[model samples]
Target: MKKQFAIIGMGRFGSSICRELFHMGHEVIAIDTDEKKLSLARSFTTETFVGNGTDESFLEKIGIRNFDHVIVAIGDDIQASILTTLHVKDQNVPNVWVKAQNDYHHKVLDKIGADRIFHPEKEMGSRIAAYLTSDTVLDYIDLSADYSIIEMLATKKVAGKTLIELDPRKRYGCTVIAVKQKHQVDVTPDPAEPIKEGDILILIGDKRDLRRFREGELS
Candidate 1:
């Protein structure tokens, strides 16, 4: 299903979203105050506009209300971002997602009724911290304050063992969600499916269980 999207900023984050949506065959209206940024986004977006996003008249003129989803990706100027988001919400756009710079920014967006808030910097920091803190954790995604999904390399002890054989749920309270190999990804691995030394296991569960698994406590 295709949807119309409006992106209010042309910085790295907004540009990336515009490009991805366009590549996925969605209609994207990219708006920015900077002429240079608008020029850069021209080839990637379906439509480009140079205007002050916080201006309600400008937003109205551009048919912002027609968009199914609007992303407020304004960088640096928290005031502008908030104003734009408020205007978009006032227009009653069905969904509004905002990129927040910090905790304060997130709180403001939440109070103003943003459907979703993303902190890319904080998320990337967490991912980098996971890599730096442990050698076993190939990737980490925070599912909640106490839950996470971790991609871990199968150690020698776990190689050739099946889900039923290892029984991670019983031992560690975690579930193996998928197995990723060089050539394929198995989302529905059988209970008897064998694990290889180089296979990457995608597991989901409470954060404590993940930490225990990472420290080789459950091996």
Candidate 2:
């Protein structure tokens, strides 16, 4: 299903979100105070608005409450970000996500009822650290503090081995949730299926166990 997303900021982070959501076939409204930024976002968003998001009058006029999700991505302006988030929540938007510049900003957003808070730089740093750990790790998503889902490309160490032989769950405390071979995806692959070189594996496990598996076995 498609969603209506309003992104209030046109910085790098906000623009990226707008572009991705638009590409995913969702309705995206990009808002920013800078006309230049809005011009850039116009190509990627369903609509682009040049205005200060902190202005409640403007927000109300634009019918912000109708959006399924509203993202407060005001860059550097902490006060504006908080005010925008508060106003958006007051309008009863179903989901309100905010980008925080620091831990303090995160705490403030938490107190103000942001459904999700993202620390882009910090999160990306952790992801890059994971990539540096092993070439097999293609992508990472944190499910929680202790759990994660990782996309890994099968290498010589893992190729030609069946799940029963590898015994990931018993040996590494991880489970291969899905496997992608070429254009096909096998969500419920047989345990006896042989993993081929260059196949993508979607694995979920405790972070510590995943780290140990990547460093000790896959590396």
Best by lDDT: 2
| Native-to-model Cα distance after best TM-score fit, residue 178 in candidate 1, in Å | 3.2
User: Could you give candidate 2's per-residue lDDT for residues 132-190 as a string of tens digits?
Assistant: 33569888998876799998888888888888998878989999899999999999998
- Write one digit per residue (lDDT tens) for candidate 1, span 141-171: 9788779899998888788888898787888
State how far residue 25 of model 2 sits from its true place (Å): 1.1
Give per-candidate clash totals: 0, 0
Q: Give the local distance difference test score of model 2.
A: 0.83
lDDT of 1 at 106: 94
lDDT (CA) for every model shown?
A: 0.82, 0.83
Clashing pairs in model 1, backbone N/Cα/C closer than 3 A: none
lDDT of 2 at 33: 92
What ranges in model 2 sit over 4 Å off?
A: 124-219
